[model samples]
Target: MERAVRWDRLREEMAREGVELLALVPGANLFYLTGLHFHRMERPIVALLPREGEPALILPAFEVEKAQRAPIPWRLFPYTDAEGPASAFHAAAAALGGRGHTIAVETLGMRVLEWSLLAEAFESPTPLPAEPLLARLRMVKGPEEIAAIRRAIAAAEAALQQWLPEVRPGMTEREATRRLIQACFAAGADALAFEPIVVAGPNAALPHATPSERPMGPGEMMIVDFGVIMDGYVSDLTRTFVLGEPDPETARIYEVVREANAAGRAAVRPGIPAEAVDRAARAVIEAAGYGPYFPHRTGHGLGLEIHEPPYLVQGDRTLLTPGMVFTVEPGIYLPGRGGVRIEDVVVVTETGGESLTTFPRELRSL
Candidate 1:
């Protein structure tokens, strides 16, 4: 019933946006709507949702049984590998009335193969970008969604708390990554959000650096960026750490990033433009003369996918609303040297923003 309400909300948004149908492939939107997981493969699995009719589930024959357990009744159009998906797509389109209708699709998530099928089935219908409509429905999370994110956060923080103390001076970044992955599962993680970004010293200069064989020694710091998946949601949290003692310059940069993260979080509130948060955080980093080193946006929306709508960056004028969740990550990465990044998840509230990530922000030595 809860999931049905989510569909109803999507339909409402669709109506408001003049969307007659939503054509989705196997991705977060499909999983979000049907609560079914389908790994991306050459074989296409599509869903056609019409505004005023029964939703159609076009998938492989083997997957039809799973749709029976879906909360909402979906008109099934199953296809066998021998039969192929063309018939299923054509049947769904004929049943849903696709010609000349305003169809919307995830321009980013849907593959060209799926798009070609959709075009042939719908007689070359030009699909509108569904992101704006989907964002309207998904950006502001409900209470249950927030709770799920909290569970993910709890597991992530618990893993960090247990793993940080075990850090030794001579372990390679790859070794450190292995131990963190084990801790996440031991601490009750359903899955990892992304590959653990365990980088030390110069390697930390890259925002999404892969773990290397470089051994972290005392007097140098490391940046550990990781998250855990739980209850169908993910948490993203980053913290910089020192082995024994930090250089004075490194310590100062860490403090600068910490303050910027706080400012970004503080700027969140109902009715403010989303870019305001970016400006608030960037102002701090720029004032300190490290603006050029801050390459990425202040943060991004977090929920179903690692990166989503209401991006915290310049020129994004989406107004902040209560229940919207995002991150406030500010970093200063020097090209040749190390970098400092402090990331925390925050949700917009009627009063202000509430941080979902509560693991300490203080710079500590391992």
Candidate 2:
């Protein structure tokens, strides 16, 4: 019933946007609507949802059972490898009132193969970008979604706790990353949100640095960024640590970034503009003379997709509302040295914002 309501809402939105149908490939949107996940393969699987009448799915013959388990009723158009998907696409298009229909699609998620199939199926099909409509629906998370995110956060924190004690001075970044991945799964993570990022010394200066063979040593800073996925939702976190005592400059910048992260979290509240949070955090770094080094937005929305709408960045005027979840990450990187980034996942409430990640923000020395 919940999924049906969501599909109905999407139909209403499509009607208002002058779109007669909305097509989705195998991605977050398809899972969001049908509670089914399909891998992106040579054979394309597409869902065509009309403004009225039953939704239709064109997929491989083997996936018919999976399609039948969807929460909402849908017309199935299954095809075999020998037959190809053209027949299924044509059947779906006919079910959706073929020819010259305005179809909205996720511009970023759809593949050219799917588009070509759609074009061949419908006559002079008008394509509309469905990003805005989908973004609006996904931005505000419901109770079940929030609960799943909280579970993911707890799993990630537990994994970090289990792996932190095993950190040794001579351990390579890749070794630590492997241990962390094991711990996440042991702590009940369904999967990782992304590859674990473990960088030490000069490599920490790179915001998206990959874990390398370089060994962690004393007297330098290391940044460990990771996340865990549970029940389809995900949690992202980054924490900078020191092996022993840090230099005066490194310690100062850590404090500055920590303060900036706090300010960004403090700025999250209902009705406030999303940019306000970015400005609040950026002001702290700029005041401490590290404005240029603190590049990238403060954070992004967190849910099924690691990054989504309601981003905390300058000039994004999207208002913060209750049930919206995002990250508050602020960092400062000094070239030829290291960087400090403290991130936390937070959800907006009617009164204020609540952080889901409670791992200590204080500088920890292994």
Candidate 3:
């Protein structure tokens, strides 16, 4: 990633908004800026990007060496565990002229501890939400980010295909989850994007169900929502399956969801609102008399984070633009029976949308 170019865009937005500095915690935004992945722990780490100067960081003493290896230069303030983080925060604040300046922070990512420390050190400066500015910059992905997402999709699909053969009628969901993790690593994944949602039958009705000790049975619907990380990018894909031939009702649900997924993808263009996709897909489901069964937004932006801006739901009027990538997933869940969801990662092109995920959408028996 070209850190300087991204930083320049951020700085420009800061100036326009009267934001003197940007405070970041360790996560997608931090990694996007510094290419460093420090774990968010009790020690509290914050990287500050000023409107006009080199960046500064308040990190542990042991992490200074790693921060130095970052793509861009930094003014580091290292603190030891015994000394605590207060003094280092104060020093960095003074050096960056942060006192009494309007600062931007990630409302979604910053913890209370980190915010409190900054408040004390900077004498309670006005804090503003940095989400809009960051979203504007990160929503439209670049060439390298696109490539990394493709690689992540490839690895995740390959692992799923390899793990499919091992899924049996009597296999426990937890046991199956273990096998899926092994398959993901074998398929060259840097990490699992999130815990694989492997649930069968009634369990599948819940969108984010956790794997349990309950056994999967033949002819039961299985929802496999999984993703993997490759080159720091993520791929989220969901494909519902059946251990045996699906019942007529189950099959119809799957078909409705598949058509909705297609409509959502086809609705994409360079000059339309993001919610158009949701309306197109939702119309299909509602027409089939399954409107209330389908819950959640039609999709979400995909890149550095599994969920981001340009959400495919009503009230989001952000115009679709080239280089923007997001998911197009539509699902229907029956309270006591099962659920059907087909998701694919899609990219906005000069003319229309192109699916980055190539996994087959056709319902197949495991």
Candidate 4:
């Protein structure tokens, strides 16, 4: 990450939006600005990015060493645990020319404790929503970020290849989930992007079902939705399989969902609206008379956060650009039966989209 370039862009954005300064709590925005991550606690840690000059941070005294190694030069105000962070906030506010400054804050990330401290620091604090600006900054991935995401995808794919063959009809969903987790770790994953979803039989009908103790049985569908994290980047993909021979209805639904997933991926390209991809995918299911059963958006942007900007949904009209990465997942769920979902992580290129995940989309019988 180019710290100076990022700061300069953010400053330009703040100026255009009439935001004098930006206050970020300990989260993705803070980590993006400075290469520092702090735990959310009673002693609030906040990073302030003024329209001009170097950024400043208010953190616990014990974290001084970590702050010193940040990627960019910053004014540090460290407070001892015994005294709390009130003085640090006051000092940081003064550094940024406090009192009546129009501040921008992350609505989703700033906690009440941090907000109250910021409110007390400024004389007449006018807070504006910073999500739109921040989203603009993070929507496009740099080469390093794309590389990290590819590594995460590779790790996840390796884990699945190693674990899927081991799954048997008698194994419980929870047991299968545990095996998948272990395989991911063994395949060099730093952590799981999210909890592995292992649903068997009718449980597979639920989009977000938790892995239960119910054993897998023959003549039923199984859904495995999972992801792995590598270098802080995440990969999300889903593949459905069968324990035995799938019924005719199940087979038809699987093919329809597979075609929808393909359509969604094919629709991804530069200069197109995000919703175009969703519509392309949804059209396939709707044409097959299973539109209502295929709930949820086509996909969401993925990077430092599992779910982020430029979402593939009905109302999102964000134009697709090169370096943008997201998923293309389409599914069909029957009320009393099972569901079929095929997902792939796609990256927009100058020409079109490329899938980062390479797991076979064809329905498998284990």
Off by over 4 Å in 3: none
TM-score of each: 0.97, 0.98, 0.98, 0.97
What is candidate 3's CA lDDT for residue 294?
88
lDDT of each: 0.91, 0.92, 0.93, 0.91
**Between which residue pairs do clashes occur in model 3?**
none
* Pairs in clash, predicted candidate 1: none
Ranking by lDDT: 3, 2, 4, 1
Q: Write the per-residue lDDT of candidate 4 for residues 1-366, one digit (tens) a residue.
A: 487788878988998899988999887888777767888887888888889888888888998899888766889999998898988999999988889988899999898898888999886699899999998999999999999999999999999999988999999999999999999999999999999999988899899999999999997899999999888789998999999889998999999999999999999999999999999999999999999998899999999888898899999999999999999999888876888889999999999999999999888999
Of the two candidates 3 and 4, the one with more favorable lDDT, higher being better, is 3
Residue lDDT tens for model 3, 59-130: 999999999887777899999999999999999999988579788999998999999999999999899999
Model 3: lDDT to the true structure: 0.93
Q: Name every residue pair that clashes in candidate 4.
A: none
Question: Which 10-residue span in candidate 1 carries the lowest summed lDDT?
Answer: 94-103
TM-score, candidate number 1: 0.97
The candidate with the higher TM-score, 2 or 4, is: 2
Provide the lDDT at 179 for model 2: 93
| TM-score: the better of candidates 1 and 2 | 2
**RMSD, one per candidate, in order:** 1.2, 1.0, 1.0, 1.3
